[model samples]
Target: MPEVELLLRSRRVVTPEGVRAASVAVAGGRIAALLPHSAQAPPGAAVADFGDDALLPGLVDTHVHVNDPGRTEWEGFHTATRAAAAGGVTTLVDMPLNSLPPTTTVPNLHVKQAVAGPKAHVDVGFWGGALPTNRADLRPLHEAGVFGFKAFLSPSGVEEFPPLGPRELEAAAREIAGFGGLLIVHAEDPGRLDAAPAAEGPRYAGFLASRPRTAENEAIDALIALARRLEVRIHILHLSSADALPAIAAAKADGVPVTAETCPHFLTLTAEEVPDGATEFKCCPPIREAANQDALWAGLAAGTVDCVVSDHSPCTTDLKVPDFGRAWGGISSLQLGLPVLWTEARRRGHTLHDVARWTATAPAALASLGCKGAIAPGRDADFAVLAPDETFTVDAAALHHRNPVTAYAGRTLHGVVRSSWLRGRKIADRGTPLAGPVGRLLERA
Candidate 1:
């Protein structure tokens, strides 16, 4: 093994075993060893000593949208990954849609990867899209090294990426199962949505009513049944309705290969806090009431929810018009998810170890990135140096994302990321990304 090239000592280092005072030794861009916090650095090894700040495994957010190639105005890889680094995210898997080619085929996937290769500031991977007509592309794309396939049960907002009907979704799932590939879904029953009252005008209540919990519950129940029968691994994306927790838990107990993820918006923001016409808060599976948020937290603590990710979707400011009905539905918080999550997690008495699992370990496992996530030997030396007790008020314009628009605009958050290192190289320092893009394009390990 190569000699240690760098050493990081922290009073509180979050590791797979738990949080404790430790010194992490790094060599050849990977973790070499873990020792006591007071361990001395070997000859020729550079050292950084963090007295009381917590050193966490760099977060891995599996749900992010970087609309490059076709919609660079919305967000490109360069700015998006920069924001991710600033927020302590070391690795992210880009969503299939939103980008120009949509990643529905091998060629499209290659195009997006080519565009991202020169721009990403963090290690990035791709997810292929699953449409009714793209059935043949499933295995080929998976073989081409996409992490998984993403399918939507209802309208996908954009005309290019249409949702799959029940039969089409089943076909996609069955096909994915044959090849041992994962299928993640945007679960909202279109029938329930069509039956609900129209969400027109500026009222948040009107928007909330349009995406009822029944939609999520019905969709989840059907997915559970599908997983049980077809024996395919299905991941529920950005789950908002806590009413479906019991069914999800039951499915897990029954040994159905089903997992679910909720976004930071659902965990922190609430409909009551969203004023009328604040379209920035508008997203599909809309943020629910305070009680619903509470239930979601409880579900998270009880292990019913698998992980928390940022569905970091952003659009041009014009696309985010003031009216809730007219504005685009997405939230861009790649630059704020760490603090946003920590602020809420701490209040609930959750430890940094728990945060690391939800944001890093679970996400890495979900995507099957075996060599990343935890601060253990043989893993990439990805670390997020956080002042867990520090506080900061968000200023949208100060963020590194392409557009200065986010739902976390003015909120105060805890746990500021003082620095972030990817593969033993500092990518972000004092909430700013260092010059040059050091990220690499990643495929399935």
Candidate 2:
């Protein structure tokens, strides 16, 4: 038998089969076996018993914006991954846009890796950009091993990363398809946004009106048609409008190669409750009403929405202007995604298995990270010991992210993450100092 380096026994170990009493054995940084709960540890092997706390596969958040390099002040690899560990996320794929020289070229990706390689505290991968000007760079970026490419149909908030026009979008899709790479898009129609009334105040209603659901629905329709015609793999990022769910369902049913993800904010908070001047809740394709949120939940249940991610975009507090129109739009929820989603999901009759599927398994599958998102043997021994019945009140100042701005402040949440393991090593534990910057910079296989 292989020498087990560590044994984690739990009364509630979440596996692909289901949650059950088991002892997970780790050897050489990967899971070695799933033995009975009372299984004895191998000689000299370290053991940690979690009792009834759910031992879940560490989460895989594929929609994070780490924004290192030039935007490190907003969020960097060190703080972002540390925050991810605190939230029970073991792997996160960084989005390309917000960083300086966004990963559109091989050299830019190298620069990003150099900075992140030394600072990350959890496994990190990257997505390359599909900007209007970088069509030729797509194949090179893919060959260099970015997980996929990110494009914006509407204007990206950054001036350098411009949106792809219709022609540019199709050209890029074709180029990516030729290489069999995935294309992830921020889909909000530019024309629809331009036609909407200008938002100029602190009122949440005005901001909601400025970015209507039609913007998302129309953009998704265009992307679906293009995906069907080109036969390229496509993923919709941070889907906020439930009206587009039906079209997404139909696209998938028709064999269009498409998938979609929604964020924790959309599932947990409603526009009706956002107070005026609460710019922290200001994200593009803004959070909608309760009915829309309910539909989003239904979409997840029906599998029209493949996963939930934090979309953990953050900017300096100074950038968060009191006026909703002027503020930079994003929600900083990297450290709160699991608890926030679990608190809401459990209330809706969902189980921990359901939460694991949305936050880990599906997102891992979306990014094609096979070794992640599960507790089975031959997979990375990354796990989160979560006390599902434990509760906590959010306090922004206490979070590990560089910036303490978050929309979840003051809210009570369930499922406190007691500790998180990365590759069989403890990287984070509640009330303990972070272990070290030992995370690997991953490449697509």
Candidate 3:
């Protein structure tokens, strides 16, 4: 038998060097070599040839909320990872909130891994929560291989994972910096939110008014300043306000170790587009106006925004009540991130290469997942076979997410994911259904 276990050839293979016709040779679940597209496959090796479809590195979504172990009703590893594979994401880093006992300690991390090990359909990593009382757990969790620490500048919705105040925020930063760990923050100023009038009723305008651009801007400014003074790395999560792009750019230029990510909901959906009773469009740092969305697109084109991820936070239907203030604030879009981004990105004259870079390359770099986000030698043989020209209308009920509700309920999107592979094994296919859970837990070194 040949040493190469599997060989995949594609006419439009997206590589770091750029898209070209190439054949990938796989051995021991890692990419062994890249040959010409028409190269002959060795004897006794499984071969698959995609004549016109584009081969892309599986996406790495760093911001995902798999509310499992405690709140499995909201979402669990089995459902979430299956949705991930169907959406062409081969690796994910779950957020540390809304789960039972949250990932605030080393023991909690183990509990999550134990539950996720058997159910996940894709490789998974975790982020440790940074609450006021969990300061002592930071170093231990990092040593335990958590990717980083997650904090909020304001009250997190769940009472279990409270937000970090100014003093506590600085203290956490110092502790994490002492160990050279990354601190990812949900930056929304509490004072600004408290000062804004209560956003009651089902009016989308009222909800949008409550979480104004000033709230996100002020919080990001504080984070940038804090990272500069403490000489620590900080990451801004789910950045919706384009008003803060200039400040972030200037700080990055000034050598402050700060990075930012914007979600697909903010980029595609807008405040004007959402109906009053559409609670699914309601998310923290609410989607802004079209002009602001334009600025965000410019930020992506100019490198001000580091990556685009689906902040795939979901809850049961009962949580999505009619009242905007009373309903839960999250968008369920894990299964549609790629096509959603592509539909809009291609409209803006962007190519699949740009999409691959933002969704795959940049995110893997952010989480420091070395083996993921590329189709080159020495990397995992994970790939997303995409028909860039093909299109489909999203059906929420047919999705793999536990809850059938989604923000992309009837949108027609481009770029169909024909198949997704993890470590040379086909885990999900648009045509063939998943056979079993073939995922493993990942850790940061």
Candidate 4:
């Protein structure tokens, strides 16, 4: 009766019918109606039309590394969520490690929520840590609203969160399975990495050689076998080895409860293109050759890769210096995943709808976020209005993240987010958060 609140019309609106001109009605922070361009609006409703821009469901990036609490100097909720808003991401799930106390216990999860309460500008959820010692705390953290649990098969690059051995991994998986929780893993085999040559010097090849495809494939094979025997849901994180794609496909075909994801760096940049000593391009399970990149994209096209979320792990500038052997192995692209993906995806003949599926819908499904991720009745009014054809050069200093260190620093990218709305309210462009914390700690159903 109150004029239905607002109407946002766009030339390209991603919907069940595909991208087309449509006017969406919003009321009480949810989509009230989706109508044709010429349809009448509810009386007195305010309207804003994006002439040539596309209106997409705000991206749900489930793999951001907002190292807050103890490591807020690296990244925090305030800066990370502001970056998310500008990047067209409306919802993000924070990784458990890097933060002090990590999100292993129920008390630690509360510490994270309390720290993030007044700072976040976009909707945020969390993942729990799966340290060997924390498996006993899994059910309690899951019950307390953590989306799922994260573990590593190799060293986690941090002293606080160590990797689990095969037996420890199975034990943790069993605990998670007993609670009906999911286990997301950083699947690089320690044994294979140990067998490989040590990475040294400035050459990217040396670094790439240290973490080979066999490391990923071998670790994945173990995970697949464990998932089948343990009856647990397992997701491989930041998959870079294309050789493992067939194994993943076969496991899925055989009904193993396993899924995998790849980051933007893997899909956009290849080992051939990376210059020696460019530590910014360095990441674990290092970016492989162009042929491998093509295979990773093929995996996405064939639906073997479930999602394309930015594993936006960032650190200080000093940590990402020119020395490849000593620098941190992560990329900071939380605010640029859309444009980076769009630039490469279009050249490869993929659509924005595919981008939406990879960046928004699929990630939400993986995290079990029911109200976020899509444009539909009863869903949160989270949306991104983009000038899909606009191009912009990257300037790391202009970004909202705490550290101005990013791999996309000089590259040009397509797709610009003109505006973003969260639960019927515009943020970043205008207005402060309505009241208290808008993000609710999410849980999987």
TM-score for candidate 3, please give it: 0.99
Candidate 3: which pairs clash? none
Candidate 4, residues 206-256: lDDT per residue as tens digits?
Answer: 999999899999999999999999889999999999999999999999999
What is the C-alpha RMSD, rounded to one decimal, of candidate 4?
Answer: 2.0
- Residues 270-291, candidate 3: write the lDDT tens digits: 8999998899888998988999
lDDT score for candidate 4 against the true structure: 0.87
Order of all candidates by TM-score, from best down to worst?
1, 2, 3, 4
> What TM-score, to 2 decimals, does candidate 2 have?
0.99
| Ordered list by lDDT, greatest first | 1, 2, 3, 4
Tens digit of per-residue lDDT, candidate 2, span 39-144: 9999999999999999999999999999899998999998999999888999999999899979999999999999999898999999999988888899999999
lDDT, candidate 1, equals 0.94
| Clash number for each model | 0, 0, 0, 0
The CA lDDT at 114 in model 2 is 97
Candidate 2, position 6, lDDT: 99
**Residue by residue across 258-371, what tens digits does model 1's lDDT show?**
999998999999999999999999999999999999999998998899999999999999988777778899999998998999999999999999999999999999999998
On lDDT, the stronger of 2 and 3 is 2
Return the TM-score for candidate 1, rounded to 2 decimals: 0.99
